[model samples]
Target: MKLSRLGPVGEEVPVVWEEDRAFDLRPLTADIDGAFLSSDPVAQVRVALADRRLPMVGEADALRVGAPIVRPSAVYCIGMNYAAHAAESGSAPPEHMVMFMKSPNTVVGPNDDVAVPRGSTKTDWEVELGIVIGARASYLESAADARLHIAGYVVANDLSERDWQIAVSGGQWSKGKSGPGFCPLGPALVTPDEIDASDLRLRSWVNGEPRQDSRTSDLIFGIEQIVWELSQYLILEPGDLILTGTPEGVALSGRFPYLTPGDIVELEIEGLGRQRQTVVAG
Candidate 1:
């Protein structure tokens, strides 16, 4: 099942997409958040759909698509998890996962305008597969056990500003990653049963020109391992977002120019969905 939040930002309503139709899930939950997922959102949605208890909303295209989940506890990211991306950025695959955090406030509706932070020139794009957690996970015993904790997945654009990320601020990547609207997520939250996260094709384009084009199959630290490894260091709570890293072809690789005002960025993860954002001056 595909889940989503639709409407203007901060006023979105929970919704379910099935058979090419959108149905309001407000009768079941106020918002799709950690609390909602913890209550077994999939099973509840199934019952609602089967009982015909959900109200049929208009076509999904009629509403503004917000990020699939609201106010996620934290937004975590794996850096250089793709070997090709690492090579493009002039780094080798790390022996251990490299993790970073983005301010939750950076989360925005998939189609919203992305602001180029003031005095910025190196804003870049990363198309990644985002994993939404379903249950609390701590010190997971194995990579296999990690799969049980996943609720769903979404397409994500891990927008970055290379200048602040590397040149200034003493090399803390998160510095450039935490700007408002830095993370544009959604189109829909696809449940695990609906899509395979193992080897999906993910890609991105800037103003109609293809930039990043690669597959999750190239991930050095796959989904299960990312969760398992992260669990050993930090608790993975329901509704937490994990950006599983992006494949090669980002502007950071220096092949393309950094984003500027009026540029449009589009991202897609096979089966998860697509996202488009227009860059605007801050």
Candidate 2:
């Protein structure tokens, strides 16, 4: 079921689908953490919402949507998983996955404006498929088993600064990618069963113009394999998000160009929904 946080005036509430309507579930489980309610809490919330017996959320009129996951333990990313993106970087496809981390502080609402860091001249955007972990997993035996731990997907823009990424600090990429507001996540976190992950079209546009365009089919290390590989090292906790990598159309790919202040970045993955944000001076 599609779950979200809504509320009245200033308080945010946990809500779930019930009988085709949204209902507040937080009141019933007052002391429980919303993120930990992934199990029957979601199911109960759905049922309670469906039934008219549940109390009406009097504050619904004032609610604002927040990032679906409040506090993910970690945000991991796969770099250059798309062959064409690797080719554009002038590097051969790696035999092993290229991994990086974006600080959790960087996560922002999908529709929020992207803050262009003061020193950034080469701000860029990457359209990617975001994997939200549903269950704890570690040392996964195989790719086939990886899907079991995934809850769903979301569209993400991995905003980057090429100079901070590659040209400085001895070429540590995360230096540039981990900046605040670097990760724009969620139109929604769609359950894996709700959409086909392997064949969707991924696209990004800057200021209403197309930039990156490619398909999941071009990914060198697809979702399942990437998850399996990641599980071998880091423990994947519930709510941890992993970016499945971007396609060949990123500004870093050198086909079109890089982003500047005042540019609006828009991205979408078929079935995952869409995200749009404006780039502004820090």
Candidate number of the best lDDT: 1
lDDT of each: 0.91, 0.77
How accurate locally is residue 232 in candidate 2, as Cα lDDT from 0 to 100? 95
Q: Give the range of the ten consecutive residues with the poorest summed lDDT in model 1.
A: 163-172
Q: Write the per-residue lDDT of candidate 2 for residues 1-282, one digit (tens) a residue.
A: 555555422354656543345566555654223245345344555566566556655555345555556657798999989888888888899899999988987877677788888888888999999888877889999999998888777788888988898889475688899888898877566676558888899998988988878899888998899999999998998788899888887777677667777888899888777888988888
Extract clashing residue pairs from model 2: 18-50, 19-50, 212-249
Candidate 1 lDDT over residue span 1-282, tens digit each = 899899987899899988778899999999999888878888999999999999998766788999999978899999999999999989999898999999998989999999999989899999999999999999999999988899999998899988899899585789999988999999889988888889998888988999888889898999999999999999999999999998899888878899999999999888888888999999
- Candidate 2 residue 223 C-alpha distance from true site, Å: 1.2
Model 2: residues with Cα > 4 Å off, grouped in runs: 6-12, 17-21, 27-42, 52-64
